[model samples]
Target: MATYLDTPGRVCRSLSEEDMELVHALQINGRASFREIADVLGISDQTAARRWARLRSAGKLRVLGLTDPIRLGNSVWLVRVRCTPDAASSLGKAMARRPDTTWVNLDSGGTEISCSVRTRSPGPEESPLLQKLPRTPQVVDLSAHCSLHVFFGHDLGPINKRGPLTAAQVAALTPPDTPDRATDATPPVPLDDSDRQLLDLLARDGRAATGDLAAATGLSPSTVRRRITELRSAGALYFDVEYHPDILQQSFRAALWLEIDPSRLAEAGSALAAHPEVAYATATTGTANLYASIDVATAQLFYRYLTESVATLPGLRHTATAPIQRTLKGPGPYLPTTA
Candidate 1:
């Protein structure tokens, strides 16, 4: 069954200020209610709710709740699969359906499929594709980079319009950063069935109504709300808002592979995340210990960032760059109108 987000022939339009404001608000706090968002933006709750419904119906926006696999004591790895031309489409789609893979895409050439996969540990069936690919006739080559430290990914991307939300407005929308909440450095926790169900619903729409969730899960609205709060406090889930990069004039996109000293790895990753050009970055276990995604205005600007900015970082041993020809799947489902 096809969904509106993946349906064909959808119209792609640019977002207005109202739309942009709502998008930014969600980026700040994905679970904020229409009333809370309205309070911050000085609009009616109905208006905020209607606008969001329109955006989702038009396939212009996506809100996702994703678990940090690495923090969960799972192995996160970036994989590049080289397959025959005929097998590319089928192989990529097959990998995307797996619960383990995220950000799956067919790179510049259709023959190569690039994606990141997470696993609790190494086993024959830990990553079905990784193990099976080596023996499969169509898969010619495979490269896997184990993510050691993640500076940024998913929800950590920079917001398009930062100036629209005043400091007070942002503070109003944001949840209090309690001591129990997990940070990048914090360890992981175990999740129960209810937690998984909440995550599954939020993965489809982070702003889903508590009443709707209650209906689906056979739980009271209050129980659903309390569960969400508990999960958030445990740092078991975080929300990601997906939007078109071209809207912000970042047309050129590139993938970076870097090698750094093990001792300074976390420090280096943190520094890379501070740069606006870096949409994603991580420290992996491979020849190239670090990997990053860059979105810039022009090719020249990317070159300058690589030479001038990236060069200044300490313990940087080697670097490699690859351009992302196309994105088959991003944070959430690949939306044709939005992408």
Candidate 2:
């Protein structure tokens, strides 16, 4: 099947110090010129450009804008799912393909899968993802919990952070007067095991060579090259970036867990998912109907989002904020590496 790689957020398995620095530079300011990044790292512009191409081509980096969903008028939900052991992967993939889904992950301890998605209701609403979900046939029973805030969106995008960026990288990455374009949809493609392995390599070390991927996947260098060509053509891969939330002055990021009527799930969830501010939204089964995270500049901004933005959403039962303390990992945690 064809897979699209343009999900709202991104993540990597691991990164080196220099790679982290590069990710930081882009996160702080994505529009930085090769020359500017070079200056900060004390490298040449040509070198910066070359390394960037490698990372970007491999889907180890991204340059996209993030907005606060509440500001865009949306409610949130967190879903904990209990599925048949054999049904988890199929169910998760189905959810991931939805336009409203922002993040999807499975935990090993149980038959539970967790997902977060956003929705906007006209007068406090339920998420639509639930309706579509039961119809898909992979899920058994679902349980949902509303979120007050995101403890951290670890594994969402590139970069590991305890707090804000340091002085130098931040200075280099500060958002430009004009930022990079943020598009949710992109092309699609078929991915093979070799492509997966190559993507894994770049996720950890962007500067890794084709020969390295060739060796890792047990394919000839030429075969690895062919698969990468297909992955890029199909849009199943993108680069990893070290985004600096502080540079954008986004000191606050939170999730609001909400409950809504199942009948109104589709209507409410669709509206919320369309907003630019919503990182991602989804419908799930259980106690709380929906969950999502938002990014904003300050406490006042958060209020505005709540009062004006979220107030207007449909099917909203309960809405409260739980702010993230720290992100232990990005949205997509690293896959285990072999060889």
Candidate 3:
């Protein structure tokens, strides 16, 4: 459980080391049983459950189910919108409310908005970027970068690879990899109405009990379990954990866009992905072929990382950085509690 200071500001303290270990355990396997987690963490099951409840009630953490766009034959785009200074907040909130948008953020002194949009195949007239945004009067300019390849993010989120977990503990808690049934040569696994309903419920609470999921989806427990397994095995579903960044003592966040030599794109992307400061990295289309989300403890530390780590990347031709002022939406479903 977390503690709060009794100072004039009544500031909340950061999570304790044990609490972070519990968080890291869930990152390893979000659906793991409390008893299982306790066993690995060397704590009692009741204590583990109580700590999780406290953290969740405090809105410090969440577990969510996310889908893979490529596995589902969909596309993802990173859109940057330059709007009127006064309209930036409204436009950002509107975009955050859209089910298709995630990672909605306000940057560049509250005059620009950035978001990731997931879209199924749509005609030009139906495309949000191609048709809808251009018609908005308040939007001064817009650029949508189609993701060509993801070097990090999704199931390989920063916490999944780096956290409080020791090598032995991580290995003990890590679940076996689900088989990859989603291949380019194979057609995407089709989702039925039931599948959609299940996904919606899990998106809100990935660790929802099997019985609760069965009751909500109007299916037997066995059937619900089987379907979840099938979806995960097909690479169509995955669990992601979200927590307050302060737990990791990170206070600065920034978005980076870089234009790299085409021949060295993969090399540059991989190097950026491996850096501890980066939360997400991908190769995209447009003037800046590579984009990344960075997190650090301070602005000075960020500058150090930029000069020491990022500046040394191979074939880096041009670079642009925008400090993220606020995040309206995260990787999971939109929730007002999300920072």
Candidate 4:
């Protein structure tokens, strides 16, 4: 167990305000080229490329395809908890190491620690996903909320004409990367507006059958299937489930945030990312900035793990937690529109 006194044994820093603005632009549309970001941020494409590279080397960002779990036949849950004022945060931080958890936020606004979790149920007849919650401790309060809507992924606050995603939501969905993109170009194909309409249908319902897709897309079933296949092959479409733990019976989740010494960031980040209970970790720019999402069975189980497992982690000190209400979105590339 690492003592609180040794907190921030290493430090991880986020981008500057200028960098953050660029990030917001890129995050709003990962497909945006350095040229696009530079155009928006009023900088040269070379400068944008350098800044993005720096952001990645700092372990501060990622860009992947985000998916919806409901269409994939999964469940979602929100777990909120409270622990000893001193113990509350540390407990949350430990459980975040678990793979079962997905989103973690510690000491969010003021009162509670929260985590939003998504789980894949074992079987339609078997509810191993929900029944599995009580097996762990370190949770005090657990509640459930539906992910009614997903307004935006990168930034959730209000939007206006000046906001990046406001007037151009759909147009902002797909992006074109800068010159040094991560991969080589994909071979081209022939899919016209009708084919695009088919894609739009699948976007709303990934599980839609070929016949249904064809009907909605105004194409032959075979053509629809071929195009869909091509899209999936081209890395454009994916299918997966989103689990609702509360409905399935496992509503326990929480977000854990840790503050570590700047000197120990690499070691600490690597160690915590590989922790047993932690699900997600983000190195942010604030006092207690290391954020992770965790999941556990019960408050008692949560307690045992914290006191026994995470309490002793090296290079860790101060901690905080909050109960998650819902997964704003499943663990896919949380992206804005292409517009």
Candidate 5:
């Protein structure tokens, strides 16, 4: 087992260099063949497969196929809720169990919860962020921001930058870049029931064998492969590798809400997105129009980032930091704990 100190004045173990390399390879391409990963890492294919199995069985990593909300004509809302001290845990758990919520986390000393909500349409009635969350008596305050433009954190994740893979190794594992469909004018391809079923299975395990998927979905292996290609080409689905941050020796995480001059919003957002510490950055609608999630090794490093990386942004007006105390859900569907 690997670990890292969540707070100062504590020490914890972490993944070995070889394991970290394996993780980085998957982050580049979650569905890469074991032989491909082995070739890049200079290890045997059997070793690569064994390592991945061990990691997966331990719940230390997951490869998930995620849908693009924007491509599906949906809106993503970043919601922050302030709750009474005693109610935060239960509230966080409840939010995590919702299908529309991701990145559900406890923050601001466990008094505030932050999560992202995806809605199929643009109305208060259709959005849990607007309709259901504010109704809770234990919730003291709630704010939701509509994401306008994402500067980064979709195609690639923070691990790609922080992991130990060399440039050549990363390039070896990375698939060739294709034109982004999210910005194109093409209407999204509609998904049939079979498509949905395949997606659901992939959401649980992106690298599931084609035969298994065929058996589960009653589609032939060739059909499963073809559908995956079509969905990926249409930009309706993509893959993400999830793991504990401790594997990378990054224990501290925080969300940033920043107010920037309107004229400089695009420039600042792009600039912040390029920073190594930032995992996600987007422009949104609210008092603080820019939002980012950052991970680092320690509080001192975080301070240095604030001063060296963020302080110099042009037209910076105000900034607020909410430390993430725990994450209840990530990029994939939330699975409730079984009794």
Candidate 6:
């Protein structure tokens, strides 16, 4: 029997082991060289290059260097905007184009748009694009949830037990700890024009070569490299890879919104984070204090996990579940990735 990495949100249907191995390598170090990945996976550099080309051309994968909004002098907010059906498409697209939003999607049959935005200040008035909208008749309602803490995010990019890399192979690709990965949190630092350009390019493709970055930013290769290191150490740059859940045979997906006693927020977060089915979980401000995105093999499996697994957690007050209708934009820099 052979395995396949299903391409959801696209026409493709199957992916080979080599294809997944290539993805796994990039996930560990998005900017790794084809030759380095080839050496670790026991394939030729040419083979690794060919596999990457195939996956990327099919739109089954994307490797991006995403910056933490908090590290960029911004606050992260989860915003849900409800619009009339006639206005939803245009409104969703308009929201997606803004520089601050990520993971934008049309849920609840296209009448509701869910997205996370980065604001320069703490209040809703400080949101770069969303604040401009008036509560006109066309816009039915809007709610904003400020993300207070992130327990699991970019650090776990689609992790699964079925990953293609072996323990030894993964060990070979892991990079040594840098100051940026330290426990101490640092305040957001300002960026000049050149730094922004570099991040914009990396956001599109973190594996872009030095020469490519130099040309794009009009800086020498050495200068580009130096700036990248500095920004990284300052906790400004991190990389993540995106893939649809269907690829792993975990097709059922839903987002859980829960209200928990404030005193036990950490206990609830840590408990939820321990579940393999939980993809992304966080503590936020809004009607629900905790939000989680989870994927499972089927509805039965999801129900079992919820009743048997999630029900056991302490301080869990209320819960709500919304099936992700279609991902209009997956997580990444402000780019829109639609199904």
For this target, which candidate reaches the highest TM-score against the unseen true structure? 3
Model 3 regions lying over 4 Å from their true place: 1-12, 122-125, 179-186, 245-248, 337-339
- Cα lDDT of model 5 by residue, 163-275, tens digit: 89999999898766433847636575688899989999998888999999999999999999889888877778778887644454667888999999999999999999889
**Model 2 stretches astray by more than 4 angstroms:** 1-14, 122-126, 134-138, 150-165, 176-339
RMSD of candidate 6 to the truth, in angstroms, is 3.8
lDDT, candidate 6, 114-204, per-residue tens: 8888888877787646666555566888888888877677646455344779999888886553334323266677899999999999988
lDDT of 3 by residue, 154-271 (tens): 7666665667788999889877755553445656679999999999999889899999999998999999989988888788888777765445456677899999999999899999
Residue 49 lDDT, candidate 6, scale 0-100: 91
Quantify all predictions' global Cα lDDT against the true fold: 0.73, 0.53, 0.81, 0.47, 0.82, 0.74
TM-score on alpha carbons, each prediction: 0.86, 0.46, 0.92, 0.40, 0.91, 0.88
What's the alpha carbon RMSD for model 5? 3.1
Error of 1 at 280 (Å): 1.2
- Global lDDT of model 6: 0.74
Better of 4 and 6 by lDDT: 6
Q: What is the C-alpha RMSD of each candidate to the true structure, in Å?
A: 3.9, 12.3, 3.8, 18.0, 3.1, 3.8
Worst 10 residues of 6 by lDDT: 1-10
Total backbone clashes of candidate 5, pairs 3 or more residues apart or in separate chains: 0
Give candidate 4's whole-model lDDT: 0.47
Give one digit per residue, the lDDT tens place, for model 2 in 136-158: 55677775554433322321231
Candidate 1 structure quality by residue, lDDT tens digits, 222-300: 9998887766766667777865433444556677888888888888898988887887888777878888888776889
How far off is residue 187 in model 6, in Å? 2.1
The whole-model C-alpha lDDT of candidate 2 against the native structure comes to: 0.53
Which residue segments of model 6 deviate by more than 4 Å? 1-14, 160-162, 177-185, 244-248, 333-339
Consecutive 10-residue window with the lowest summed lDDT within model 1: 1-10
- Clashing residue pairs, candidate 6? none
